[model samples]
Target chain A: MPQSMQPGDAKAAEIKAVSIGKTFGAFHALKNLSLDIGRGEFLTLLGPSGSGKTTFLMILAGFTAPTTGRLMMDGKDITDVPAEDRSYGMVFQGYALFPHLTVEQNIAFPLKVRGHSSADVKRKVAEIVERVGLTGHEKKLPAKLSGGQQQRVALARALVFEPSVLLLDEPFSALDKNLREMMQQEVKRLHQETGTTFVFVTHDQSEALALSSRVAIFNHGELLQVGKPQDVYERPSNRFVAEFLGEINLLPLDTVELNGETAAGKFEDRTIVLNKSITLAGKKAVAAVRPEHMFISASPQTSDCNAITCRVEGATYFGASTKYHLRTRSGTSLAVSMPTASTSPIAPQSDVWVSWPVHQGFLLPDGG
Target chain B: MIGKSITSRKILLLAPLLLFLGLAYVVPFLGVVRWSFTMPEVGLGQYRALMTDPLVQSVFIRTLRICLIVTAAVLVTAYAIAYVWVRGSSVQRMLAEFCILVPFWISVLTRAFGWLAMLSNRGLINTWLQSAGIISEPLALARNELGVIIGMTHFLIPFAVFPIASAMRSIDERVLLAARGMGASRTRIFWTVFVPLTYGGLIGAGLIVFVFALGFFVTPAILGGGRSVMVAELVYLRIFQSPDWGLGAAISVVLVLFIGALLALMRRFIKPAHLIG
Candidate 1:
């Protein structure tokens, strides 16, 4: 990838990872992954367990060093800098507030490490106490605080130092659903109020969508994609991104040939043609269409370039929407999601026509 | 009915320990207490003699002082080893455990005798020093407070290690990591997080090791020789050599009362379960 020419492209304060890789014995925990985050952008690293998100975050925070390559904060190499000297704020998975220290002391710890005077630490700690909505908790020890209050204190401790970037490792995985959503908004509000670069890690895609400006999807120690939340979710680059981000109907093609302006593929018992470029010379491919994009009707026409004859396998009704599982004669299962209305096209055992625009389906390279 | 059954079950499990303590501990201990008051064909006769006998009273006082020193030394040394295991890498932790358990497998008499050979004036250590051309003459190694302290510390390191190490292990790793991430140095983390959390173990180990060191027979007897006369050896001499069972029982009674006082003080200051765990 070519580097962007703009030097201070608002991402100037962001952490830059260069050829970073970490391995434990023979197992490669992280590959040669590089990313340049935009400054003050809420970027969430989304992946399942062991996808190297936490490893990358730890390397960025200077707690753990990368096996190979380097890191730069604010345009200077800080790969070998110790965790204390790097001055990066971090909220760990378990909130990790000191049980021995009161809320005020916990919040003032990073400042104290920075050699702040008692008067200044007290003033800043009080300010942060208000900032995290933990006003009366200053005198209470961490053990006395509720889970949500402990989380707030941890956040206050990180933000009090006002570091260049804040790294949060699954900060909300411990909270219940309602509190998780509330804290998500609270974090976003804090970010907006401070304009501090926030790098977060989570396995939940909904969380990434709800809070992040850009979500980096990772799998098996490799970065699958990184883009705006809607861009990555709606227009995925491959099948894995599509499957991981949300539900999608994956239809395999036996063969795909790109001929001038036209693209065509042969399914099990029939042939399909597309008027758009397929980008494949001669290789096996598949088209991934999101479940909600499939338009189903009672009858189908041969004149329609984007249509398939499918029999309904099952239908499931969510509160506001219904999902229909359609199987073609060749036994290829395709999902069609339609908004519930007065006239519903899908009930159990109904014959349906699955149709969508050619642009709605993407021809993913095989095994993507 | 259910409450009675639960009480019976508890009693069944506790019965063997109660029976063992009854014969081995309480019976002999009560006999000594009874004998302390019945010496010289008069009640409290030998018990009053201890207060009048300067030499014997000094022996008890000296025993307490040396035992306190040994206990303090063992707690500090064992804490160093425990702190290392709590924070150090796997290999360092395992090697420390191996060193501690090695002495535990060997007999206490062998350990005491081993110290005797090491601390002896013309022992292996002085021989090595003379051959190395470091010292012209043999240094004092045996029959002194130095020799007794050295032997007792070696014997008690394992007892100290078990509780302190167990307490250090129970401490959550996240607590230390949180401290480090918050920019506490290695030294600061140990002092602030590890030490306070392991306070219970240190106190418990100190109490147990101190009480055991007070009545210590083999190490001090062999190494102290004539100079360091602990209460246990004095009692042994009175009962076995001089046939003074009354004086022996009186000394035994004093030792038991002193140990009980030490335990009561420890309990008042710190909780035992917290430390031992």
Candidate 2:
């Protein structure tokens, strides 16, 4: 799964962005955006649709300019640099391969455009073809190649020059699930071999977790949270972050109070205490518990920090894990995922108890 | 739009233009064709004599040369305009397109009259050139093929600009950006990406402009003033001045065949539907 992947530690080209903002007349496409992408790090800006992810990447690519602030690379200000002069490799969404050129010609394009001699172009393109695992398909036109192969050609063309950074904007969003997964690994391996900083944009959380050294979750034109995938998944800063990373169970303050949970206990059903001291005041204080954290049993247990007795609304048998839907007395529902159910497996419509540790949950600010 | 059945909906949704063309244009064209063949009670005589005439052949050759030059000039200028507009800021692009449209709205008659005012012996340009001591005797600017070509090219710029520009615009700008990000320079990007991507539009526009130029009459008549006679003016002379309707209609039919064959050959190369988006 390439989970052990680590970017080369040595200092490489550093891209430092500072408070970049862009507005398209009436719409604020990007606002107050700033992120310092470490040299050789593969960072992904993860988000749902319309989260300003692509706008941030385009600012880095130099195609769209920030209305305010500046961008620097290795301490050299490059805010106003043209895209062509930025010397970056990019895999555009949908892989905008030149249809008129054959595979060899497409790969040779960058070299020829840089004014390399014809022989040099031929040799360099041939070497890149093999690098991208497209050695035998040089003569084929882009249309003749499958979507995956065309994608590889795009990556190869972008990589042939070995630009300072590689920018990808949903490069595999067009491929099927299997091909997409395969290309994800291929891209990770290529990053390892070349040791280039890759800033990828995508909405797929699993893909982000699979590839990035760190993932930055974005929402409503702001960076919601950024950390190692595991860290971010296990610990999100707010409700949006918690919900965006994965499926989350939101416990209202009352639910915590009824269970006598000290962490995030209720105060007027709006505020809660995560500890003995703090009285968090808000219209709605909510705690997010991951679906995997909750366990289902045949009966309620008093010792459990957080437990609720609800009817087993439904059950799903996945080969390895069994998921159960439990509805509380207040009609609130929760999903509990576990490797195996009890010896007396809870059936649908049967009363059951759900339990999880208090420390596993977090209080998120109300979305409003 | 060019085929029989005039309304061949199976061919294209816009096929009704062929019907409109047949009614308004083909009827008059056939009438001319019949008139050119059966004048003076009929024979192969008027066309045969007309073909042998040295003046008629020279004028035909001269018109072909004029059309080629004007087409070339318009294509180059239109490409430059479209390229600049495509890459410029939105405001500049809108302004450039608006500027191109301005010359189109001004009538050809008014523009030719404006050219007459500008290129006459005592006209504004010649007056300035004379005052600047750059030329003498008005430089024979008017009453020649030079005046005719200038006016014709001026009127034909929009036809040359539209199809090519639309084609160029449809070419995903991302392809050029991808090439550049891969280390392509401006000139390389132009020749390899932009040129090839928009080739169909350019050729289509060029063919249209060249074909339209072959049959132009008003600008050439007003500008050339009998010193430079294009084939259209020669046909007019044969029809009305000499009462040689047979020669005139034959010339008209020949011109139609020339332009029609060009349109057909162009359709073969420039089918926008088969072109990859």
Candidate 3:
């Protein structure tokens, strides 16, 4: 794995995007986005469609130029560099393998184009093929290979030249659920093995969370948040980030009061205590808690937990866990996911206590 | 049973086309075939004469040479046009489509005459060149093999453009981008990734243009001005002027068989789907 990198390439390159923005006529595809991608980091740009995540990745790959901003690699500015000179590897969506070339030829393309010796090209292609687990399938064209095999070929082709940075644009969006998971694991292992700076773009929250060293969330061309998966998931800064990451119950709060390291807010008649400090603005706020963090109980389980009384509306059994749909007394709908094994089969229309630790709930600005 | 019924229904749906081809094409082709061997003496005498005829041999060789030249020129030019048509901006694409399709919709005779007017010694191009002092006299741009090639290449470009453009359009743009992202220069990417991907289109276009050029009659006849006669024109002269229907039918039969063999050979290299595209 270490020999794959050429000498003086042990430390991967870092990227800094400063005040990057892209506009297409009247539309804004990205707006004043600033980010620092550390060396050898696996950063995933997570966003909905048309949310500028792909736009940023393209900017990083030098395929699309930013309308305004400086893109720096290590320390030098590369905003004007063309994609060919960037020395980046990109796994495009649908794999985009060369249909006419066999897997070996496809992987050998970049090396040949770079004027590598024929012997070097053959040796590198063989190495990358073995690394990507495509040993016996070298002679097969992309059409003859299965979808997963085609994906492996694409990956091998992109990484054969040992590019300084690797960018993947939703490379697994076309695969089935099981194959996507398998490829995700494959990509994670490759990222670990190669130690190249990887900038992956995807809308799958779990994919972003499970694979990335850091996740950058985008919405409406705005960089909403960037943090570790746990940091963003457990402490989302806004309602959109909280909801986009996963299903979360946002209970509208009123009369919010801020204190050091904690905030007290009112949820109808119940006073909710959040263990994190939050600044108050003119707009409303919501107490956002993931459904998995809250448990359904017959009565309050602990004095240190915030409890809410709600009537069970429905229950969805999901094999290992059950999701209980509940409505508060003031008619705020909430969902609580509990382990099916420990759940006592609460009936609909029955009042139950939903309790979570004080630190599990966080405050977010409720734009709605 | 259901599959058999579906096959029968499909054949029924194709009945009109089958009837049209049998009457319009197969019947006439069979007449030509019958005349090739059993005309003017009910023997293989015409074919024997054809085998040794120097005029026939020269005409066939010249026709092959012209078809090869025209196919090569048409594929190279149409590949460029098709590339623009597939990957260019909307305005450029519209212009390319207009250039290919407008001449396509015009009559082949009109296009041939158009080329004649442009390429003739005393025509627009020569006159312009002479008036501009680029030449003291008109160059022999028409009334020769060069004139015939120019006319045939222009006429066949539209045919080449469709298959090439369809193949180009179906290529994944991201493949080229991926090549670029992997440190391949634009020219390198074009040669390595873009050109290889369009091999199907190029082969399909080459075959269509070559086969079409083989059977061409009007462009060569008009542009050749009797000096550069092709096999098709020879067949025309044999039947219409000399009234040698046996020889004419034999030539026609050979031309058809050659084209069929060429298509069969090409089919070994390219799939029907690629050709259609």
Prediction-by-prediction clash tally: 5, 2, 0
lDDT of 1 by residue, B1-277 (tens): 1245567668888789889989999998898888778765767789788888987888888898889899999998988887777667999989887878788789989988888888798889999998999998888888988899889988998788878888888877766776777777878777777788777788789988999999899888899987988889999888888868898899888888888998988888766666555
Q: Please give, for residues B171-265, the per-residue lDDT of candidate 3 as tens digits.
A: 78888788788777788778877887788889888998999899999999999999999998999999899969999999999999999999998
The best-first sequence of candidates by lDDT reads 3, 1, 2
Q: Write the per-residue lDDT of candidate 3 for residues A1-368, one digit (tens) a residue.
A: 42565434545789999999999999999999999999989999999999999999999989899999999999999999999899888899988887878999989988988889999999999888888889899999899998899999989888888877889999999899999999999999888878888999999999999999999999999999999999999988888888999999998888788777888889978899995645766557889999999998888767779999999999999999999999999999999999999878999999999999998998887773
Ranking by TM-score: 3, 1, 2
What value does the TM-score of chain B take for model 3?
A: 0.95
Please give, for residues A1-368, the per-residue lDDT of candidate 2 as tens digits. Answer: 21222356323477988988778897877778788888888999999888889989999898888888899998999999988888788999989999899999888777766778998887778777887789789999999999999999999888776677999999999999999999999999888877888999999999999999999988877887789998788777777777788888876665443324455455232333342222345445666679888887666444535666678888888867787777777776788888874434667898776777766766665562
Interface RMSD of 1: 1.8
- Against the reference, the lDDT scores of all candidates come to 0.82, 0.80, 0.89
DockQ of 1: 0.42
lDDT of 1 by residue, A216-276 (tens): 9888888889999988877687778888888888778887877666566777655666544
Model 2 misses residue A235 by how many Å? 1.5
DockQ of each: 0.42, 0.57, 0.79
Show the lowest summed lDDT stretch of 10 residues, model 2 chain A: A269-278
Q: Report, to 2 decimal places, the DockQ of model 2.
A: 0.57
Which pairs of residues collide in candidate 2? A264-A273, B36-B246
TM-score of each: 0.86, 0.86, 0.93
Candidates sorted on DockQ, descending: 3, 2, 1
